[model samples]
Target: MKKSLEKLLNKPLPVDPFMPQRAVITDIEELAPDHKKFSFAFCDESVNDSWNHIPGQFVMLTVPGAGEIPISICSSPTRKGTVELTVRKVGRKTEVLHRLKPGDYVAIRGPYGNGFPVGIMEGHNVLIIAGGLGIAPLRSLIWYILDRRHRFKEVYILYGTRSYEYVLYKEELKRLRERNDLKCLYTLDKFETEEDRRWADRKGLLTELIPMVELEPSETFVAVCGPPVAYRFIGKELLKHGYPESQIFVSLERKMECGIGKCGHCQIGYKFACIDGPVFPLWDTKNLPEMI
Candidate 1:
Protein backbone atom coordinates (compact mmCIF):
# COMPACT_ATOMS: atom_id res chain seq x y z
CA MET A 1 0.00 0.00 0.00
CA LYS A 2 2.84 2.39 0.72
CA LYS A 3 4.43 1.73 -2.64
CA SER A 4 1.14 2.19 -4.43
CA LEU A 5 0.48 5.43 -2.57
CA GLU A 6 3.92 6.80 -3.45
CA LYS A 7 3.37 5.94 -7.10
CA LEU A 8 0.02 7.68 -7.09
CA LEU A 9 1.46 10.77 -5.47
CA ASN A 10 4.31 10.94 -8.00
CA LYS A 11 2.04 10.88 -11.00
CA PRO A 12 2.59 13.77 -13.44
CA LEU A 13 0.26 16.78 -13.42
CA PRO A 14 -0.44 19.53 -15.89
CA VAL A 15 0.67 23.21 -15.70
CA ASP A 16 4.35 22.91 -14.97
CA PRO A 17 5.87 25.60 -12.75
CA PHE A 18 8.24 26.78 -15.45
CA MET A 19 6.24 25.97 -18.58
CA PRO A 20 2.92 27.60 -19.31
CA GLN A 21 -0.06 25.36 -20.09
CA ARG A 22 -3.12 26.22 -22.15
CA ALA A 23 -6.31 26.35 -20.08
CA VAL A 24 -9.80 27.12 -21.31
CA ILE A 25 -12.19 29.15 -19.23
CA THR A 26 -15.39 27.20 -18.52
CA ASP A 27 -17.35 29.79 -16.56
CA ILE A 28 -17.17 33.30 -15.17
CA GLU A 29 -19.09 34.93 -12.32
CA GLU A 30 -19.02 38.61 -11.55
CA LEU A 31 -18.88 39.03 -7.80
CA ALA A 32 -18.57 42.82 -7.78
CA PRO A 33 -18.06 45.75 -10.14
CA ASP A 34 -14.31 45.22 -10.37
CA HIS A 35 -14.05 41.59 -9.28
CA LYS A 36 -14.84 38.41 -11.19
CA LYS A 37 -14.41 34.71 -10.44
CA PHE A 38 -13.04 32.60 -13.28
CA SER A 39 -13.23 28.82 -13.57
CA PHE A 40 -10.80 27.02 -15.86
CA ALA A 41 -9.80 23.55 -16.99
CA PHE A 42 -6.61 22.31 -18.58
CA CYS A 43 -7.24 21.90 -22.31
CA ASP A 44 -5.66 18.48 -22.02
CA GLU A 45 -7.98 16.26 -19.96
CA SER A 46 -5.41 13.61 -19.02
CA VAL A 47 -3.57 15.87 -16.57
CA ASN A 48 -6.64 17.63 -15.21
CA ASP A 49 -7.24 15.37 -12.23
CA SER A 50 -3.50 15.01 -11.54
CA TRP A 51 -2.88 18.66 -10.68
CA ASN A 52 -2.72 19.07 -6.92
CA HIS A 53 -2.12 22.21 -4.87
CA ILE A 54 -2.50 23.19 -1.24
CA PRO A 55 -4.58 26.10 -0.04
CA GLY A 56 -2.87 29.54 -0.02
CA GLN A 57 -0.63 28.71 -3.01
CA PHE A 58 -0.87 30.94 -6.10
CA VAL A 59 -0.54 30.58 -9.87
CA MET A 60 0.75 32.97 -12.53
CA LEU A 61 -1.62 33.55 -15.42
CA THR A 62 -0.83 34.96 -18.87
CA VAL A 63 -3.20 36.88 -21.10
CA PRO A 64 -2.01 37.03 -24.69
CA GLY A 65 -1.28 40.55 -25.97
CA ALA A 66 -1.44 41.87 -22.41
CA GLY A 67 0.77 40.18 -19.75
CA GLU A 68 0.92 37.65 -16.94
CA ILE A 69 0.12 38.22 -13.25
CA PRO A 70 0.15 36.23 -10.03
CA ILE A 71 -3.25 35.09 -8.75
CA SER A 72 -4.21 32.94 -5.80
CA ILE A 73 -5.91 29.60 -6.43
CA CYS A 74 -9.38 30.13 -4.94
CA SER A 75 -10.80 26.62 -5.33
CA SER A 76 -10.13 23.82 -2.87
CA PRO A 77 -8.02 20.85 -4.00
CA THR A 78 -10.96 18.65 -3.02
CA ARG A 79 -12.69 20.02 -6.12
CA LYS A 80 -10.56 18.13 -8.60
CA GLY A 81 -10.47 18.69 -12.39
CA THR A 82 -11.00 22.47 -12.10
CA VAL A 83 -9.24 25.59 -10.81
CA GLU A 84 -10.71 28.93 -9.81
CA LEU A 85 -9.23 32.44 -9.78
CA THR A 86 -10.86 35.49 -8.24
CA VAL A 87 -9.45 38.56 -9.99
CA ARG A 88 -9.82 42.23 -9.10
CA LYS A 89 -9.11 44.49 -12.04
CA VAL A 90 -6.36 46.91 -11.11
CA GLY A 91 -3.81 46.86 -13.95
CA ARG A 92 -3.34 46.18 -17.64
CA LYS A 93 -3.10 42.38 -17.35
CA THR A 94 -6.15 42.18 -15.09
CA GLU A 95 -8.07 44.61 -17.31
CA VAL A 96 -7.46 42.29 -20.26
CA LEU A 97 -8.51 39.32 -18.16
CA HIS A 98 -11.73 41.07 -17.20
CA ARG A 99 -12.65 41.41 -20.85
CA LEU A 100 -12.32 37.69 -21.50
CA LYS A 101 -15.50 35.62 -21.77
CA PRO A 102 -16.08 31.96 -21.14
CA GLY A 103 -14.36 29.56 -23.64
CA ASP A 104 -11.29 31.80 -23.93
CA TYR A 105 -7.90 30.12 -23.49
CA VAL A 106 -5.16 31.58 -21.28
CA ALA A 107 -1.64 30.49 -20.39
CA ILE A 108 -1.09 29.22 -16.85
CA ARG A 109 2.02 28.38 -14.85
CA GLY A 110 2.85 27.41 -11.26
CA PRO A 111 1.15 26.74 -7.96
CA TYR A 112 3.86 28.85 -6.35
CA GLY A 113 4.80 29.98 -2.81
CA ASN A 114 4.77 28.31 0.61
CA GLY A 115 1.18 27.80 1.74
CA PHE A 116 -0.53 27.61 5.10
CA PRO A 117 0.72 24.76 7.33
CA VAL A 118 -2.26 22.47 7.22
CA GLY A 119 -0.38 19.60 8.88
CA ILE A 120 0.21 21.63 12.05
CA MET A 121 -3.30 23.03 11.99
CA GLU A 122 -4.99 19.66 12.07
CA GLY A 123 -6.93 18.98 15.33
CA HIS A 124 -6.56 22.65 16.35
CA ASN A 125 -9.34 25.19 16.40
CA VAL A 126 -8.90 27.45 13.33
CA LEU A 127 -9.71 31.14 13.07
CA ILE A 128 -9.52 32.72 9.62
CA ILE A 129 -9.71 36.47 9.14
CA ALA A 130 -9.93 37.97 5.67
CA GLY A 131 -10.34 41.62 4.68
CA GLY A 132 -11.39 42.95 1.28
CA LEU A 133 -9.85 41.00 -1.59
CA GLY A 134 -7.68 39.08 0.86
CA ILE A 135 -10.48 36.57 1.13
CA ALA A 136 -9.52 35.13 -2.26
CA PRO A 137 -6.59 33.03 -1.06
CA LEU A 138 -8.04 32.34 2.38
CA ARG A 139 -11.17 30.96 0.76
CA SER A 140 -9.11 28.02 -0.45
CA LEU A 141 -8.07 27.23 3.12
CA ILE A 142 -11.63 27.57 4.38
CA TRP A 143 -13.01 25.10 1.83
CA TYR A 144 -10.19 22.60 2.42
CA ILE A 145 -10.90 22.56 6.15
CA LEU A 146 -14.62 22.29 5.63
CA ASP A 147 -14.25 19.37 3.24
CA ARG A 148 -12.27 17.45 5.87
CA ARG A 149 -14.19 18.92 8.79
CA HIS A 150 -13.67 15.90 11.01
CA ARG A 151 -9.90 16.41 11.08
CA PHE A 152 -10.27 19.83 12.70
CA LYS A 153 -11.75 21.14 15.96
CA GLU A 154 -13.75 24.37 16.03
CA VAL A 155 -13.65 26.59 12.94
CA TYR A 156 -14.48 30.30 12.82
CA ILE A 157 -14.38 32.82 9.96
CA LEU A 158 -14.36 36.61 10.12
CA TYR A 159 -14.67 38.48 6.81
CA GLY A 160 -14.87 42.26 6.35
CA THR A 161 -15.45 44.29 3.23
CA ARG A 162 -15.79 47.96 2.33
CA SER A 163 -19.55 47.74 1.92
CA TYR A 164 -22.40 45.38 1.11
CA GLU A 165 -21.88 45.79 -2.66
CA TYR A 166 -18.17 45.16 -2.32
CA VAL A 167 -18.58 41.86 -0.50
CA LEU A 168 -17.06 38.96 -2.41
CA TYR A 169 -18.44 35.43 -2.33
CA LYS A 170 -21.73 36.49 -0.79
CA GLU A 171 -23.70 33.36 -1.72
CA GLU A 172 -21.02 31.01 -0.44
CA LEU A 173 -20.72 33.00 2.79
CA LYS A 174 -24.43 32.59 3.29
CA ARG A 175 -24.05 28.84 2.86
CA LEU A 176 -21.16 28.83 5.34
CA ARG A 177 -23.41 30.57 7.88
CA GLU A 178 -25.94 27.74 7.50
CA ARG A 179 -23.38 25.07 8.38
CA ASN A 180 -23.63 23.80 11.96
CA ASP A 181 -20.02 22.61 12.01
CA LEU A 182 -18.56 26.11 11.93
CA LYS A 183 -19.29 29.76 12.74
CA CYS A 184 -18.97 32.85 10.49
CA LEU A 185 -19.16 36.58 11.15
CA TYR A 186 -19.53 39.22 8.45
CA THR A 187 -18.81 42.93 8.83
CA LEU A 188 -18.52 46.02 6.67
CA ASP A 189 -16.68 49.28 7.16
CA LYS A 190 -19.85 51.32 6.89
CA PHE A 191 -23.52 50.62 6.51
CA GLU A 192 -25.44 52.89 4.12
CA THR A 193 -28.95 51.52 3.92
CA GLU A 194 -31.38 49.88 6.28
CA GLU A 195 -30.97 46.64 4.32
CA ASP A 196 -27.20 46.82 4.80
CA ARG A 197 -27.63 47.26 8.52
CA ARG A 198 -29.99 44.31 8.66
CA TRP A 199 -27.78 42.12 6.47
CA ALA A 200 -24.58 42.42 8.48
CA ASP A 201 -23.97 41.09 11.99
CA ARG A 202 -21.54 43.89 12.66
CA LYS A 203 -20.46 47.16 11.05
CA GLY A 204 -16.97 48.31 11.97
CA LEU A 205 -13.32 47.28 11.79
CA LEU A 206 -12.82 43.51 11.45
CA THR A 207 -10.62 43.52 14.52
CA GLU A 208 -13.73 44.25 16.57
CA LEU A 209 -14.98 40.74 15.84
CA ILE A 210 -11.86 39.15 17.36
CA PRO A 211 -12.89 39.79 20.95
CA MET A 212 -16.41 38.52 20.33
CA VAL A 213 -15.28 35.01 19.41
CA GLU A 214 -14.10 32.43 21.97
CA LEU A 215 -10.62 31.11 21.26
CA GLU A 216 -8.19 28.75 23.03
CA PRO A 217 -4.87 30.49 22.56
CA SER A 218 -2.75 27.38 23.06
CA GLU A 219 -4.88 25.16 20.82
CA THR A 220 -6.09 27.69 18.26
CA PHE A 221 -4.39 28.71 15.00
CA VAL A 222 -5.18 32.10 13.47
CA ALA A 223 -4.67 32.84 9.78
CA VAL A 224 -4.93 36.44 8.57
CA CYS A 225 -4.88 37.94 5.05
CA GLY A 226 -5.51 41.62 4.44
CA PRO A 227 -4.06 44.92 3.31
CA PRO A 228 -0.69 46.12 4.60
CA VAL A 229 -2.39 48.74 6.73
CA ALA A 230 -4.39 46.08 8.53
CA TYR A 231 -1.43 43.96 9.72
CA ARG A 232 -0.09 45.90 12.71
CA PHE A 233 -3.53 46.62 14.12
CA ILE A 234 -4.81 43.08 13.64
CA GLY A 235 -1.61 41.48 14.95
CA LYS A 236 -1.82 43.61 18.08
CA GLU A 237 -5.38 42.47 18.67
CA LEU A 238 -4.58 38.77 18.20
CA LEU A 239 -1.74 39.00 20.73
CA LYS A 240 -4.01 40.76 23.17
CA HIS A 241 -6.45 37.88 22.73
CA GLY A 242 -3.65 35.53 23.96
CA TYR A 243 -2.58 33.90 20.68
CA PRO A 244 1.17 33.36 20.50
CA GLU A 245 2.98 35.03 17.63
CA SER A 246 4.17 31.61 16.41
CA GLN A 247 0.65 30.26 16.07
CA ILE A 248 -0.52 33.25 14.02
CA PHE A 249 0.07 33.20 10.26
CA VAL A 250 -0.15 36.09 7.78
CA SER A 251 -0.14 36.38 3.98
CA LEU A 252 1.70 39.35 2.52
CA GLU A 253 1.00 41.15 -0.72
CA ARG A 254 4.02 42.05 -2.84
CA LYS A 255 4.63 43.12 -6.39
CA MET A 256 5.83 39.92 -8.08
CA GLU A 257 7.13 40.01 -11.64
CA CYS A 258 8.50 36.51 -12.02
CA GLY A 259 6.82 33.70 -10.14
CA ILE A 260 10.29 32.31 -9.34
CA GLY A 261 12.78 33.73 -6.84
CA LYS A 262 15.03 35.10 -9.60
CA CYS A 263 13.02 38.32 -9.79
CA GLY A 264 13.91 41.08 -7.36
CA HIS A 265 10.47 42.65 -7.50
CA CYS A 266 9.16 40.58 -4.61
CA GLN A 267 12.28 40.55 -2.45
CA ILE A 268 11.74 41.66 1.14
CA GLY A 269 14.71 42.08 3.43
CA TYR A 270 16.64 38.78 3.09
CA LYS A 271 13.73 36.63 1.87
CA PHE A 272 11.78 36.20 -1.35
CA ALA A 273 8.02 36.46 -0.99
CA CYS A 274 7.47 34.41 -4.13
CA ILE A 275 9.38 31.36 -2.90
CA ASP A 276 9.78 31.77 0.85
CA GLY A 277 6.18 32.75 1.32
CA PRO A 278 3.05 34.56 0.55
CA VAL A 279 2.15 32.85 3.86
CA PHE A 280 4.48 33.13 6.86
CA PRO A 281 4.32 32.95 10.63
CA LEU A 282 5.06 35.98 12.79
CA TRP A 283 8.14 34.26 14.23
CA ASP A 284 9.64 34.00 10.71
CA THR A 285 8.70 37.55 9.66
CA LYS A 286 9.05 39.65 12.82
CA ASN A 287 12.64 40.61 12.07
CA LEU A 288 11.66 41.71 8.58
CA PRO A 289 10.03 45.00 9.42
CA GLU A 290 9.05 45.69 5.81
CA MET A 291 6.91 42.54 5.60
CA ILE A 292 4.54 43.69 8.33
Candidate 2:
Protein backbone atom coordinates (compact mmCIF):
# COMPACT_ATOMS: atom_id res chain seq x y z
CA MET A 1 0.00 0.00 0.00
CA LYS A 2 1.09 3.59 -0.71
CA LYS A 3 0.14 7.15 0.15
CA SER A 4 -2.13 8.44 -2.57
CA LEU A 5 -1.13 11.63 -4.38
CA GLU A 6 -4.78 12.71 -4.48
CA LYS A 7 -5.01 12.65 -0.67
CA LEU A 8 -1.73 14.52 -0.25
CA LEU A 9 -2.79 17.22 -2.74
CA ASN A 10 -6.04 17.71 -0.83
CA LYS A 11 -4.21 18.32 2.45
CA PRO A 12 -3.53 21.98 3.18
CA LEU A 13 -2.00 23.82 6.11
CA PRO A 14 -4.51 25.36 8.53
CA VAL A 15 -2.46 28.55 8.30
CA ASP A 16 0.29 29.60 5.89
CA PRO A 17 2.81 26.78 6.14
CA PHE A 18 5.77 29.10 5.69
CA MET A 19 4.70 31.62 8.32
CA PRO A 20 7.36 31.67 11.07
CA GLN A 21 6.37 31.31 14.71
CA ARG A 22 8.60 32.11 17.66
CA ALA A 23 9.87 29.29 19.83
CA VAL A 24 12.32 29.13 22.69
CA ILE A 25 14.87 26.43 23.16
CA THR A 26 13.93 24.71 26.42
CA ASP A 27 16.82 22.27 26.70
CA ILE A 28 19.88 21.20 24.78
CA GLU A 29 21.62 17.85 25.11
CA GLU A 30 24.89 17.05 23.44
CA LEU A 31 24.54 13.68 21.72
CA ALA A 32 28.07 13.71 20.39
CA PRO A 33 30.70 16.28 19.52
CA ASP A 34 29.24 18.79 17.03
CA HIS A 35 25.81 17.08 17.41
CA LYS A 36 23.16 18.42 19.78
CA LYS A 37 19.49 17.69 20.37
CA PHE A 38 17.64 20.95 20.95
CA SER A 39 14.22 20.89 22.56
CA PHE A 40 11.82 23.70 21.66
CA ALA A 41 8.48 24.94 22.93
CA PHE A 42 6.51 27.47 20.91
CA CYS A 43 6.55 30.84 22.66
CA ASP A 44 2.78 31.06 22.54
CA GLU A 45 1.12 28.63 24.93
CA SER A 46 -1.68 27.71 22.49
CA VAL A 47 0.70 26.90 19.67
CA ASN A 48 2.85 24.90 21.99
CA ASP A 49 -0.14 22.88 23.16
CA SER A 50 -1.61 22.30 19.69
CA TRP A 51 1.58 21.82 17.71
CA ASN A 52 1.72 18.42 15.99
CA HIS A 53 3.61 17.01 13.01
CA ILE A 54 3.82 13.70 11.22
CA PRO A 55 7.06 11.79 11.39
CA GLY A 56 9.49 12.53 8.50
CA GLN A 57 8.07 16.05 7.91
CA PHE A 58 10.47 18.99 8.40
CA VAL A 59 10.47 22.54 9.71
CA MET A 60 12.28 25.60 8.47
CA LEU A 61 14.27 26.86 11.47
CA THR A 62 15.50 30.44 11.18
CA VAL A 63 18.71 31.11 13.09
CA PRO A 64 18.04 34.82 13.64
CA GLY A 65 20.71 36.72 11.64
CA ALA A 66 22.12 33.59 10.00
CA GLY A 67 19.55 31.92 7.66
CA GLU A 68 16.73 29.43 7.48
CA ILE A 69 17.42 25.74 6.93
CA PRO A 70 15.08 22.77 6.49
CA ILE A 71 15.64 20.26 9.28
CA SER A 72 13.53 17.13 9.79
CA ILE A 73 11.63 16.50 13.01
CA CYS A 74 13.63 14.04 15.09
CA SER A 75 10.96 13.96 17.85
CA SER A 76 7.74 11.98 17.77
CA PRO A 77 4.30 13.51 17.29
CA THR A 78 3.21 11.23 20.12
CA ARG A 79 5.05 13.62 22.42
CA LYS A 80 3.18 16.91 22.58
CA GLY A 81 3.87 20.50 23.79
CA THR A 82 7.53 20.28 22.76
CA VAL A 83 9.56 19.15 19.76
CA GLU A 84 13.17 18.12 19.31
CA LEU A 85 15.64 18.52 16.46
CA THR A 86 19.01 16.77 16.44
CA VAL A 87 21.29 19.13 14.56
CA ARG A 88 24.76 18.33 13.31
CA LYS A 89 27.00 21.38 13.07
CA VAL A 90 28.24 21.17 9.49
CA GLY A 91 27.79 24.54 7.77
CA ARG A 92 27.46 28.18 8.64
CA LYS A 93 23.77 27.95 9.51
CA THR A 94 24.19 24.93 11.82
CA GLU A 95 27.35 26.35 13.34
CA VAL A 96 25.35 29.42 14.36
CA LEU A 97 22.56 27.21 15.70
CA HIS A 98 25.02 25.21 17.78
CA ARG A 99 26.41 28.35 19.41
CA LEU A 100 22.99 29.20 20.87
CA LYS A 101 22.04 28.05 24.35
CA PRO A 102 18.82 27.01 26.06
CA GLY A 103 16.29 29.85 26.47
CA ASP A 104 17.40 31.38 23.18
CA TYR A 105 14.68 32.20 20.62
CA VAL A 106 14.31 31.13 16.98
CA ALA A 107 11.59 31.60 14.38
CA ILE A 108 10.37 28.24 13.11
CA ARG A 109 7.51 26.93 10.96
CA GLY A 110 6.17 24.18 8.72
CA PRO A 111 5.84 20.44 9.24
CA TYR A 112 5.80 20.34 5.46
CA GLY A 113 6.27 17.42 3.03
CA ASN A 114 4.57 14.03 2.62
CA GLY A 115 5.62 12.04 5.69
CA PHE A 116 6.00 8.31 6.27
CA PRO A 117 2.98 6.14 5.32
CA VAL A 118 2.04 5.23 8.90
CA GLY A 119 -1.62 4.57 8.10
CA ILE A 120 -1.04 1.74 5.66
CA MET A 121 2.04 0.47 7.49
CA GLU A 122 -0.01 -0.76 10.44
CA GLY A 123 -0.03 -4.56 10.71
CA HIS A 124 2.96 -4.84 8.40
CA ASN A 125 6.51 -5.74 9.34
CA VAL A 126 8.82 -2.71 9.40
CA LEU A 127 12.53 -2.40 8.78
CA ILE A 128 14.11 0.96 9.61
CA ILE A 129 17.57 1.63 8.19
CA ALA A 130 19.71 4.69 8.86
CA GLY A 131 23.24 5.56 7.81
CA GLY A 132 25.27 8.21 9.64
CA LEU A 133 23.10 11.25 10.32
CA GLY A 134 20.20 9.63 8.49
CA ILE A 135 18.97 8.50 11.90
CA ALA A 136 17.59 11.99 12.53
CA PRO A 137 14.17 11.70 10.84
CA LEU A 138 13.81 7.97 11.32
CA ARG A 139 14.16 8.48 15.10
CA SER A 140 10.64 9.94 15.10
CA LEU A 141 9.24 6.93 13.28
CA ILE A 142 11.13 4.59 15.58
CA TRP A 143 9.56 6.09 18.70
CA TYR A 144 6.12 6.28 17.11
CA ILE A 145 6.20 2.59 16.23
CA LEU A 146 7.56 1.62 19.64
CA ASP A 147 4.98 3.64 21.57
CA ARG A 148 2.28 1.87 19.60
CA ARG A 149 3.98 -1.50 19.37
CA HIS A 150 0.80 -3.57 19.23
CA ARG A 151 -0.26 -1.95 15.97
CA PHE A 152 2.60 -3.53 14.03
CA LYS A 153 3.78 -7.11 13.86
CA GLU A 154 7.60 -7.04 13.90
CA VAL A 155 10.10 -4.17 13.83
CA TYR A 156 13.84 -3.99 13.14
CA ILE A 157 16.36 -1.15 13.24
CA LEU A 158 19.63 -1.31 11.31
CA TYR A 159 21.88 1.70 11.78
CA GLY A 160 25.42 2.37 10.55
CA THR A 161 27.75 5.21 11.37
CA ARG A 162 31.43 5.87 10.78
CA SER A 163 32.58 4.73 14.21
CA TYR A 164 31.62 4.49 17.87
CA GLU A 165 32.41 8.18 18.32
CA TYR A 166 30.16 9.12 15.41
CA VAL A 167 27.09 7.20 16.63
CA LEU A 168 24.18 9.41 17.65
CA TYR A 169 21.83 8.69 20.56
CA LYS A 170 24.34 6.18 21.84
CA GLU A 171 22.74 5.47 25.23
CA GLU A 172 19.17 5.45 23.92
CA LEU A 173 20.06 3.01 21.15
CA LYS A 174 21.97 0.84 23.58
CA ARG A 175 18.84 0.51 25.70
CA LEU A 176 16.77 -0.12 22.56
CA ARG A 177 18.99 -3.05 21.65
CA GLU A 178 18.02 -4.59 25.00
CA ARG A 179 14.32 -4.60 24.18
CA ASN A 180 12.59 -7.88 23.42
CA ASP A 181 9.78 -6.31 21.38
CA LEU A 182 11.96 -5.14 18.47
CA LYS A 183 15.40 -5.76 16.98
CA CYS A 184 18.27 -3.27 16.67
CA LEU A 185 21.41 -4.00 14.67
CA TYR A 186 24.27 -1.55 14.39
CA THR A 187 27.48 -1.46 12.35
CA LEU A 188 30.51 0.82 12.18
CA ASP A 189 33.05 1.59 9.45
CA LYS A 190 35.91 1.60 11.94
CA PHE A 191 35.92 -0.91 14.77
CA GLU A 192 39.52 -0.98 15.77
CA THR A 193 38.75 0.74 19.05
CA GLU A 194 37.52 -1.47 21.88
CA GLU A 195 34.48 0.78 22.39
CA ASP A 196 33.47 0.26 18.75
CA ARG A 197 33.79 -3.55 19.13
CA ARG A 198 31.74 -3.48 22.32
CA TRP A 199 28.99 -1.32 20.79
CA ALA A 200 28.54 -2.35 17.16
CA ASP A 201 27.06 -5.61 15.96
CA ARG A 202 29.23 -5.61 12.84
CA LYS A 203 31.87 -3.64 11.01
CA GLY A 204 31.53 -2.64 7.37
CA LEU A 205 29.21 -0.63 5.13
CA LEU A 206 25.51 -0.71 6.12
CA THR A 207 24.63 -2.70 2.99
CA GLU A 208 26.52 -5.66 4.42
CA LEU A 209 23.95 -6.01 7.23
CA ILE A 210 21.08 -6.62 4.76
CA PRO A 211 21.41 -10.37 4.32
CA MET A 212 21.59 -10.92 8.08
CA VAL A 213 18.03 -9.67 8.57
CA GLU A 214 15.24 -12.24 8.44
CA LEU A 215 11.94 -10.77 7.33
CA GLU A 216 9.19 -11.74 4.95
CA PRO A 217 9.89 -9.46 1.99
CA SER A 218 6.24 -9.16 0.92
CA GLU A 219 5.04 -8.18 4.40
CA THR A 220 7.89 -5.82 5.15
CA PHE A 221 7.77 -2.07 4.59
CA VAL A 222 11.25 -0.53 4.81
CA ALA A 223 12.13 3.04 5.77
CA VAL A 224 15.64 4.24 4.84
CA CYS A 225 17.24 7.60 5.66
CA GLY A 226 20.90 8.17 5.00
CA PRO A 227 23.41 9.77 2.64
CA PRO A 228 21.95 10.17 -0.87
CA VAL A 229 24.80 8.15 -2.40
CA ALA A 230 23.80 5.09 -0.35
CA TYR A 231 20.32 4.94 -1.93
CA ARG A 232 21.30 3.03 -5.09
CA PHE A 233 23.36 0.46 -3.21
CA ILE A 234 20.77 0.03 -0.44
CA GLY A 235 17.97 -0.32 -2.97
CA LYS A 236 19.96 -2.76 -5.03
CA GLU A 237 20.76 -4.97 -2.05
CA LEU A 238 17.18 -4.99 -0.85
CA LEU A 239 15.81 -5.81 -4.30
CA LYS A 240 18.38 -8.56 -4.73
CA HIS A 241 16.85 -10.37 -1.78
CA GLY A 242 13.20 -9.99 -2.93
CA TYR A 243 12.26 -6.70 -1.28
CA PRO A 244 9.77 -4.74 -3.41
CA GLU A 245 10.95 -1.35 -4.60
CA SER A 246 7.53 0.19 -3.97
CA GLN A 247 7.63 -0.87 -0.32
CA ILE A 248 10.97 0.77 0.39
CA PHE A 249 10.78 4.45 1.36
CA VAL A 250 13.77 6.81 1.47
CA SER A 251 13.87 10.25 3.09
CA LEU A 252 15.51 12.88 0.85
CA GLU A 253 15.81 15.68 3.41
CA ARG A 254 19.09 16.89 1.90
CA LYS A 255 17.26 17.96 -1.27
CA MET A 256 15.17 20.49 0.61
CA GLU A 257 16.55 24.03 0.50
CA CYS A 258 13.31 25.87 1.27
CA GLY A 259 10.13 24.70 2.95
CA ILE A 260 7.86 26.17 0.25
CA GLY A 261 7.73 25.26 -3.44
CA LYS A 262 8.57 28.86 -4.47
CA CYS A 263 12.25 27.87 -4.25
CA GLY A 264 13.26 25.75 -7.23
CA HIS A 265 16.37 24.29 -5.60
CA CYS A 266 14.67 21.09 -4.47
CA GLN A 267 13.30 20.09 -7.88
CA ILE A 268 13.80 16.52 -9.05
CA GLY A 269 12.37 16.09 -12.52
CA TYR A 270 8.89 17.69 -12.36
CA LYS A 271 8.39 17.01 -8.63
CA PHE A 272 9.18 19.53 -5.90
CA ALA A 273 10.92 17.88 -2.96
CA CYS A 274 9.41 20.26 -0.39
CA ILE A 275 5.79 19.91 -1.49
CA ASP A 276 5.77 16.50 -3.15
CA GLY A 277 8.12 14.69 -0.75
CA PRO A 278 11.06 14.60 1.54
CA VAL A 279 10.03 10.93 1.74
CA PHE A 280 9.51 8.94 -1.45
CA PRO A 281 9.28 5.30 -2.50
CA LEU A 282 12.55 3.80 -3.73
CA TRP A 283 10.96 3.28 -7.16
CA ASP A 284 10.77 7.07 -7.69
CA THR A 285 14.55 7.36 -8.16
CA LYS A 286 14.19 5.16 -11.26
CA ASN A 287 11.20 7.09 -12.60
CA LEU A 288 12.32 10.63 -11.69
CA PRO A 289 15.37 12.20 -13.23
CA GLU A 290 18.14 13.23 -10.79
CA MET A 291 16.07 12.04 -7.79
CA ILE A 292 19.12 10.75 -5.90
Name the candidate that leads on TM-score.
1
Q: Which residue pairs overlap in candidate 2's backbone?
A: none
Candidate 1 clashing pairs?
none
TM-score of each: 0.94, 0.93
Residues 131-185 of candidate 2: C-alpha lDDT, one tens digit per residue: 9989999999999999899999889999999989989999899999999999999
Count of backbone clashes, every candidate in sequence:
0, 0
> What overall lDDT goes with each candidate model?
0.89, 0.89
Instruction: Give the per-residue lDDT digits (tens) of candidate 1, residues 185-229.
Output: 989998998856865789999999999888788899999998879
